[model samples]
Target: MRKTLLSIASLLLVAGNINATNIGYSKDEISRNNVFRLGSTEKQGQAMRLSHAKLQALKGKTIDFAEFVLGSKNVTDKKMHVFLTKQLDGTPIAEGTVEVKKALSKIKWTLDKPYTITGDEDCLYVGYTTEVATTYKVLMSDGSYDIEGCNYGYKDGAWVDTYGMNKGSALIFVNAENVGDYTDAIIAQSNFEGYYKAGDNCNFSACFVNAGTTDITSFDAIVEVGGNKTTQHFADLSIKPKEGYSFDLKDVDTSSEGEQSLSVTIANVNGAGKETDTSDNSVSANLFLYPKTMERSLLLEAFTGQDCGNCPGGHLNIEAAIKKTEKNVIEVAHHVGYKPDMFTMSEDPTYIFFYPNMSSTFAPAAMVNRNTYANVSTTPIVSATDVNSLLSTIYYADTKEPYVSLYLKTTLDESTRELNVKLYVLPHKTVPHNSSIFNVYLVQDGIEARQANGGDNYIHNRTFRGTVTGNAWGYLVKDIKAGQLLSWEKTITIPESIHSSYYADETKNNVEAVLKNMSVVAYIGEFDQNDNNKHTIYNCCEARLGESHKQTGFVKPTDVNSAEAEQSVSIFVSNGKVHAGGAYDRLQVYNLAGAQVENADLTKGVYIVKVTADGKQTTKKVLVK
Candidate 1:
C-alpha cells in the first residue's frame, strides 16, 4: 500500500560563473555571493526521503501547507532543485528573493521512484532562498539526486517551490475512413459478422471534420486488430500525444490470421514532422474496438536449430499449432540449425539466411507463413502433420491487396548493446520491374529453453532471435518504389547474453523488457532475388504477443467444495427456499485470488464449501449446512 508520486520540477539558472566543484558543500556553501550549480557534477550524493507532516486540527483551525515528499535512495541523476538567495531576513541588500514563478504553484513533490524522470534535462531542482536554511544537492550525470528545499514564503509571494501534477498527454488514431455499411444502421460498427469472440462489442465514430489549419490540443483514434507494431502502438492507444503518433505494420503479426492491417496516424504535441492540417476542423470519431473473432489465424514458421534433433518435432508442431489454434495460430520459431540458434544467433540473420533456402538439410523444418515443403524431401524432417497440412492449405488462400507493408522504428542503447532499427517497405499495390529483396525478422520475447525432449522446459514465445537480411532471403530494395515507400536502418546488439541476463535479471526483468516489449519482424517475400509472386505479395507476417494480464486481487480459498458445496447449495437451492423472485438472492464464495471465502446473508440454506489454490485445500458438506 505504498504508491504516492507527485512531482513537477523545473529550475533553470546558471549561464555564467561555471567551473565550481567542491563536492560535499560547506565551503561557505561553495563561496556564495550568488550561487546556483545544479546540473551535472556527478549527481551529488542522491538521497531524499522525508514526509512526516500531517497534524490536522481543523474546525478549530490548524492547517499546514508545508508539504515535502521527494525521493531517490540511489542510482542518482539528482533532480529536486532550489535557489533564490537575496535576503529577506539576513538583509542581503541586492535583488533575488524568489519568484520562481510564485514558487511554481506552491511546491509539492513526491515520488519514491517510478515515473522515471525523462530526458533532455529537468528532473528536479528548486531553490528559493531568503536565507533561513539554504540547502543544496543536485549533481547528475548518472549520479542521481535532488534533496534541497529552502523556505521563505513572504505571504505567498514566492520562495523555494517546485510543485507537481501535469499528467496530460494523448493522441491516437487507428481506423479512419471505411464508413459505409452500418449493417442495419449504426449501434456499433468496425465490421465483424458471426464468429468473433472474447466479449464482442464494437463502435466507431470519427469527426475532427478537418484540422487543416492544424493546432489541435488533443486527439485520439486507434483500431488495432492485435499485436506488434509496438504492440499496436503501446497497447491499443489509450491516447498519448506529444510529438507522438503511430501507424505500425513492420513484419505484420497483428495477432495474425489473414487480411488485417489498418493504420491511421495523427498525433499532435505540436505535430512533430509537421503537415497534418486536414483543413481547419477535422477530427471526429466515436470509438470502441472489442471485436473478437476466431475460426482462424493460422501460420506457423519454425526454422529450428540448437543442433536440431528433428528440432523437437518442429517444437512439437509449433506447440500443436498453438493448441490447435485455440490460441489462434501465427507461431514463428525460426532458429535455423547447424548450430547458432541459441535463439536466433541471439539477435538475427534469420538463420544464416533462411538456412539453404530452408533445405534444413533435414533436421526440424517448418514454414507456415512462407509456404514450403510439399515435397522438399521429407525426413525426421518437417512433421507436425506436415506442418498441419501446410496449415490447412494456407488457411484457404484468398486474401490480397497487401502485398507487403511493414514499417518499424526501434531505439534502445544500453550504452550500446545498441538496438536501432528503422525499416519501412510499403507497397499494398505495385511491384514489378525487378523487385529485389527486403526481408527483416528479429523476434525475441521471453526465452527460457532446455529441451532435449524429456527434460522438456521450453518457454519460447515469438522466438526467432535474429536475421537482418544476411540469410540469403532478402534485403535489397535498391532503387525501387512503385507504390512508393521504402526505408532502411539497422543496429542490433542486445546480446552480451541478452545483456548479462537483463542486467542480472533486474528482479525478473521488465521495463516492458526495457522499452515497449522488444520486437522487429519484417517480411516482403520472394527473395533470392525475384521469382515474381507478382504485383509482389506473399505476406504471412509474424511476431505476436498477447495474454499477460495479472489480477490476483480477491483471493479466498481453503479447500471448499460440494463442487463448491453443490454450487453454493444450488444458489440457495435454486432460489425457491430463500424465495425472493430470482437473480441470486444470496450465496458467495470467491477465490482465484479474489478472496471472500464466504458471505452468507441467507434466509434459506444448503451449505458446505471450501477451496484453495497453489497449495491445495478442499472440503464439502451438504444442503444449507
Candidate 2:
C-alpha cells in the first residue's frame, strides 16, 4: 500500500519540473515516511504555505499551482476551500487570492491552460502567470457557474484518474460540446395556394427579411392516416440555395384522420463540434386536421344580436348539450354587431353570415343542429327534454383517427409587441374513399371575459378566432397521392380583445403564450358522409358518433327533478336497486375480492358500484343484510 501510494504521489510531479535539490523541512514541518497533516498551531518547526504574493516572484509561468499543503480539518470526506489569502508575513493583496486546487489534480487547468513552477523547495514556489491564474476562483462556488463540470466544460478534476480506492468518492463530469448553428428554414410560396384562397399563384413567397444564410434543399416528407396509405413526397435535391428560390405545393390532398407529420433529414457530412451550433437547417410543418365543408355544418348555430337580454338562457341550453355529448358539436355563437363580448371577432361577419339578409333578430334565437329554429321571444327556453333530444339526434364519428396533425411555432418580437405564428399543414394521405378535404381552425383557450349573463368572468372554452386556410366554402384537396405532404404558414397578430390583461400582462411580448394557449385544430373526414352511418339531422353531417354507434356511457346523473324523468333507468349491477325517487335498497353486495358480505332487497336508493365494462359485470355496495 505504501509503495502504491508513493507511486501515485510521484505521478503528480511527472508533468512539471521540480528542482528540490537542497530542500529540507524542519522536524515539525513534515514527518518522514507519512502523509502531511496540517494543524492550527504556530509551532517552532512547522513550515507554512506562503500566501500567493510571497511566492508570486517564484511562481514560474508554466508551473500551475494546485492546493498548498494545509493542515487537515479532520472532518470525514470534507473538501477544503483552497485560496491564496495571505503571505507567510500575513500581508493581503488584491487580485492574488485565487483558489488553485483544480490545477493540482491534473497539472493543467480546465481551460487547457498550463503552469510553470520555479524557485527552491522551501524558500519559495511560484506558478507562472497564465490565463488560468484566476481560474481557481471559478471552482470555489462548488460549480454553480461552469467550474469545469457537466453541461459545459471538462469533467470535475477531483474524480477522474483516481484509483479504485476512492471509487465511491469519485465525481462524474457532464460537459456539453459546442455545435454549429442549426435552423428550420421556411421557403417562399409560389404558385402557392395561399391561405384564405387569396395568395393563389403567389401564395408561397418568402416572408423572411433574409433567408438567414442558406436554404434547406433535401428532405423526405410522408403523410399517413391511422395505419392506412396516404400521401408521401420525397425531395432528394430540394435545395432552396441562397434566398429567393422557392418551392410550391398546390392542391395537395389532405383528407383522413388521426395525426399527420413531416420528417426531413440532411446528409451528415461535417460536424460543427459544438451543440450550440444551430446549423443543421431542417424544414418541417403540420397540415390542417378536420375536413372542410361547402356550407357551415354547425350542430348549433345560434343567431343572437347584441341587445338581446335573454340570450344568456339560450346560450346555456347549447352549452348543456355540448357537455352531455362531449361536444362534437360545431357550435357557432353568432352575435351580430354584438357589443363588449368576452369573445368576438372584431368584424362580426360570422354573425351576419348565419343571419344573411336579416337586419335584426330577436333575443335568444337559436337553430339546433340547424334542423329546427326556435325563438326565445315566443317559445319557452329549451328545457332538459329539448336539449337531450337535440344531443341524442346529433350524428358524429367518434372512432375516426386524426388525419391531419398541426404544429404551431410562434416568434415574439419584444420591440414590436408582435407575435409571428407559423402554421404547417401536412396530409396523412389521400382520403380512402375520396371526396374528402382538410379544414384548419384557429382556437384560443382560457380567455376570461365579462359576459353580460354567463358569470362576470366567464371562461370561454375552445373559442374559435378565425379561419386562415382551406376554403371559406371548403377547399377541395387535389392532385396529391396517399403519403404526400402539404404545408402553409401564416403570421397573425394577437388581437387586443383576447390579449386583455386578465392574468398575463397584455403588453409583454412572450412566445410561450401563443404556443401554450393557442393551437390550430386540424382534422379530415368524408365531406359527404351523413348521420345515416351514425346520427344525422336535417341535411347536415356531424363529426361525432350518436347513441346507435358503439360508445362508452358514463354513470347516469342522479337526483332528477322533473316527474317525467325516467323512474328506473336501466343499471347493470349484479345486486342493487335503482333509485328514481328516494329510499334505501338492501342488495347483495360483493367485494372486488369476490367475497359476498350481505344479501337483501329493500327500498330503492342511490348506491355506489364498481363496474367492469370489459367483463360486463358490476359489484354493488351493501347497505344492510
Candidate 3:
C-alpha cells in the first residue's frame, strides 16, 4: 500500500507540523462533532439537515480557500453568521460573521477565496445563522448520508429550514491551500504518561495563545526529540487577548522506548509578533515506552432522570464519587436524561443518540468514558456536582493509562430471554486516529424508581437496559492488535419496560423490578464524524447478569416516550392500539418484561403499556405487530 501510505506519512512528519499539506475537508473535519445545537434560545426553530452545499465531496476538486467549521456548544460569546447556500430554499452564495469565543471552535470564515466545484449535483451550503449565541455544532453523520448542509435558521435575512433536522450529518470542512491558521497555537494536549525510567523526565503541557490579530510580546516552546530539538524562551511574556498560557515541558527525555516521536511547538518571538500562522506552531502525540505495569478503567455514562431536580444531585454525586474514590469506575445509567424524568429507559432515541446533551444542560449528566473532557468542552458534557464536587473531577480518570482494554462477558438465557455478549479488546497503545465504537449497555439493578428527590423508593442503580448491540451504536472496534483478542456476538430482546407508571398494584402488569439486577455494560470509545475529541474513554468493564446463572423477573423498567413529547404524557401507536391520553386512566399491557400481556392481541415486541387514574399513573412503549 505504497509503503504503508509512506510509513504513515513518515510518522506524521515526525509528529508535529500541523498542516499535513495545504488542503481542505479536514480541520479534523468539523471537530467536536456535536451535542446537536443550531440556535436554541429555547427551541422552536431548527433545520439544516441540508440547506444545500453540494460539493459532492469536492467533485473535480479545486480550492485555495473556503472555511466554516463551528462548535461552541451551548454558545455564549455571541456573533455568528456563516453561509454559502445554493438551495434547500436557497439564497446565499457567501456570507459572514463568526466570532464566538472557543469551546473548541475553528471559524476560518473566508480566506484566500478560491472555489471550484463540478457535476453530479454540484451543491454548496456551509452553515451558521444565529439567534443570539445559542449552541452551535458541526460535523456529525451516521449510516448513509451525503453531506446535508444542516440546521439552518436566521430570520431577518432569509434562510429557514428549521424543520426536524434530527437525523445527523453536519460538520463541513471546505478548504484548498489548507490546514488551519487564524493565527495559531498548537499542542492542544498530548502525553502518553508514566514509565520510561532510565533518567526519568517524560512530561508535557502547552497552551500558549494569540489566535490572530498579532501582538504577542514574546514566546517559544518548541520541543522535538529524534533528531533532537528543544527550546523554551519566554522573554517578557504577554499573551492576554484571547487568553491561553499554560506551560510545562518537564524536559522530556524518557531515555529510549519502543515508539517515540514527541513533538510540541508554539514559538515565534525572536523579533516578537509576525507569526501569522506557522501552521498552528505544531502539535502531535505518541510515546509508549513499555517494559511493565499498566491498569485502567472508566465507563461512567449516567445521564439520569426521575424528572431531574438537579437529577438527584447528580445521583448523589455518583454514589459519592464511587464510595470516596475506590475509583475503577464502570457505571452506565443513561436514564431518561436532560429533561424528561421518571427514569427514561432506552427511550429518547437511545439516549439522544449518544447523549445529545449527555453532559449537563442538566440531568445529573455524566460521561466518564463516552469520553470528552480532555481539551475540555470538546464534548463529554460533564456537570454533576456534590460529593466534594465529584472528588476533584472523578479522580481525573484515575491519572491516565488506557489505549484500549475493555473486558466484558455476558450470557443469559433464562428461558430464551437471550443475551450473549463477549467483548475483550486490549490495545494498550497505538490504535487511535479517531473512528472507534463499542458500546454494549444493558444495565439494570434493583429498580425502585421515582426521584425528583429520589423518593419513590429510589434505587434505580445502573438502569439503562437496552442495546445489547441493538444499536446504541455498537460495533466498529475493528481489527486492532497488541494482545489481539477481539470478539462479537450480540443477542438482546429483554425489554419489559419502565419509566414511571410504577406498577405492582392495579395488576398494572407486575414490575417491582429485579432481573437479578442485570448488568453488562461495555466500552472502548472514540467516534468522529470529525472528532468530538474522539469521545475519549478507552477502556471499561462490567459483567454481572447474575453471574450467568440465577434469575428472577418482573423487573422491567426502561422506556421514555418514543417520539419525544411527554412532559407528563401523550402516546399513540396505532393499528394494534396503544394510546394513553394525557394524564392516563387505566389501560395495562406489559411484556418486554413486565408480564401483564394480553391487551387483547398486540404483537411485535417492546410493550410496557400501563395507564391509570385516580391514584395516578402513566407510561408508554409500543412496537406492535
Candidate 4:
C-alpha cells in the first residue's frame, strides 16, 4: 500500500485560515468578482442552504442581526429584503428590509423582534432579494468551496441549483447569540483509510471546528473500527471560536478482511466536559479491506493539438513531471481543443466537454485520473501552464489505493491484422453498475506529425488512434461484488492505413500502420452521460501488442469458484454453428471488430463467442468453416 509523505505527528496540526461562519465567501471567489454586478432588470436573489446541524446550533437562540457584504464598484442606494424560509421560494418565516447606499458596505438588519429558530426543519434558506438593473453588485464566493447543493439562485421566477453552474454564492451571514457559555467541537471534515489490505495499518484523521462560543483548550478524539475503540487525547490546543484543528491517528488495528464501519467522534471537550452540541461532533465512513493491494497506473489524458503554440511547452512540462515522479503513468494525447488534427479520433472532442466553458481554449490542458482537485477548480481540467499544480495533483493521485485489479491478455495475428484482447476484472469492493464503465483505447507512439510552433518533423507520442470499446464512454458493467471475477473478450482489427495531412500546405496523406508503435490502454472509471465532471478514472493499465500484462499482488480468493467454472465451459464451432459444452444462461457471437454477429449468419473465418452461465462468463475463439 502507498502512504503519504506527511509524518503521523505533523498530520495532527490545525489548518490555517479557517472560516468561522457556517458558509462564507472564499478569497478566490471574491477576487473573481472584483467589479461584478447583477446586470439585469429581472428580479434576482441568492440563497444558501443551511444544514440541520448548523440550524440546531441556533435553536432557541435569538437571531440578533443579518449582514451582507456588497461589492465595492457601482454601489448605489437600493432596498434589500432579507428573509428566512423553509424553502427557496416559500413564504419567509422571518423577513426584514434594509437599505444600502455605499460601495463595499456591510448592510445590517436588526429584527424588531428577535426570531428564535425552531430547530425542527431539515434545512433553512437564508438569502436576500434586490433590484440591480445596472449599477448594483453583490459579493459572492467562487462556489469552489466543498459545500455541495448548499447554494441556490433565483431567476425567471424559479429557484435553481447553482452548484453545477459555477456561479458564486452570495456573501450573507446570519448572527445569533448563544443561550449559554459552552464549548462545542464539530468534526467539519474527516479523512480515513478507505481501502486497506490485510495486515495493514488503518489511519484516521479529521478537522475539527470550534462552533461553540468559548475557546477549546483540549479534546478527546475517539475512533471506532471493527468493534475496537481507540482514544487519543490532545491538550494545549488553543482552538478559538470559528477556528479549526486537525488531528491524525495512525497504526490502528482495522486490517481485518471484508467490509468494516469506521467512525471518529470528538468527546470530553476541555478535559471531560460535554459540549453544548453533539450533533456535528461525529463522522462515519465505510471501508473495505482486501486480501491484497493492486498496483495502480494513473491515466493522464493530455488535450493538445498541432495548431496550439503552447502545446509543445505542455508536452515538455508533462514529460519532465513524469520523469521526476518515476511513477507508472500512461499518457494519451487527445488531438482536440485548438483544432482537430489527423490523429484526432471521433470521440476526442467529447473530452473537451469536461471544461467548464466547453471552449477551444481547453487545448494545452491536462487531466490526471479525471479527479477534481478540491484545492484547484471543481473540474478535473487544468491548464498546462500550471505545472506545479498539475504535478502536485499527480502526486496526490498516486496515494490512493485501487478498488479493483485489472489483467489484460492480448494476442496479435500477423496476417489477419486482428488484435485479440481479453480483460479480467477482479473487484476488491462492491461497485454500482450505473456509476462504473470499462473502456479500451488504442494509442500509437512515434508518429511523424507537423507542429505549428516546433518543427515539421515533430514526432507525436501516445497519439490516440481509436476507441475499441464501441461506446465512447465505455461498456457499462453490471453490479460487481467483492471477490467476484468478470471477464470480457473482444477483437479489434488494426487499420491498414490512416488518412491524415502532415503539413499545412499538404492535403490528406495515407499513413501506414506501425505495429511496434501501437499499444492498448484499458481503464475503468465512473461515468455520467451529461456531466463530464462526474467521470473519474479509478484505475488504468496498458499493454503493447503481442504482449501480455498481468498485475501483481492480486490474490484471488479461494472461495471464488467462478474462475474455475469459467475454464470448465467449452465453446467450439461445428458445421458453421457455435456449440457450448456446458449449460449457459446466454450466448453471443461477435466478429473481430466487436460488432455482434448472429449465429445463423456466421460465415466468418474467425469469431469470438461468449458464454455466460450462473453469473460467470467464458469467451473463446472459434473458426467457422
For candidate 1, the per-residue lDDT at 375 reads 51
Please say which candidate is ahead in lDDT: 1 or 3. Answer: 3
Pitting candidate 2 against candidate 4, the one with the higher lDDT is: 4
Number of the top lDDT candidate = 4
Query: For model 4, how does the per-residue alpha-carbon lDDT over 217-265 read when each residue is reduced to its tens digit?
Result: 8777888877789888877766656455767764467556677788888
The digit string of per-residue lDDT tens for model 1 on 1-625 reads: 1111111111111112232111110111111112232322332211111111100100112111111212221212222332211233343212222222221022332222212112222112222222212244211111111112211122233222211111110000111111111100001011222222234332222211111212223333333344323221222222211111222223323233333444333333233333322222222221222113212233456655555565666676657655654533455565544454344344333333333444434446554444333354222124443656544534432222224444344555466445555544544334434545666655566565554552445655666544655453555554444345555544445544432121344343221232234465655544442221222324434332221111111012232212222222112222222211113334344434545444444334444444333334443333432
The per-candidate count of clashes, in order, stands at: 93, 75, 29, 1
Distance from true location, Cα of 111 in model 2, Å = 99
Choose the strongest candidate by TM-score: 4
Lowest summed lDDT across 10 adjacent residues in model 3 is found at: 1-10
What TM-score, over all chains together, does every model reach?
0.24, 0.27, 0.26, 0.71
Candidate 3: where is the Cα deviation over 4 Å? 1-222, 228-258, 263-298, 301-331, 334-395, 398-402, 405-417, 422-441, 444-449, 452-483, 488-520, 524-537, 540-625
Please, what are the lDDT tens digits per residue for candidate 3 over residues 530-620? 4344555666677776353111110111221211122234344556766543355578888876788666557677888767665656566
Clashes of 3: 29
Worst 10 residues of 1 by lDDT: 180-189
Q: What count of clashes does model 1 give? A: 93
Return the clash pairs for model 4, or none: 29-142
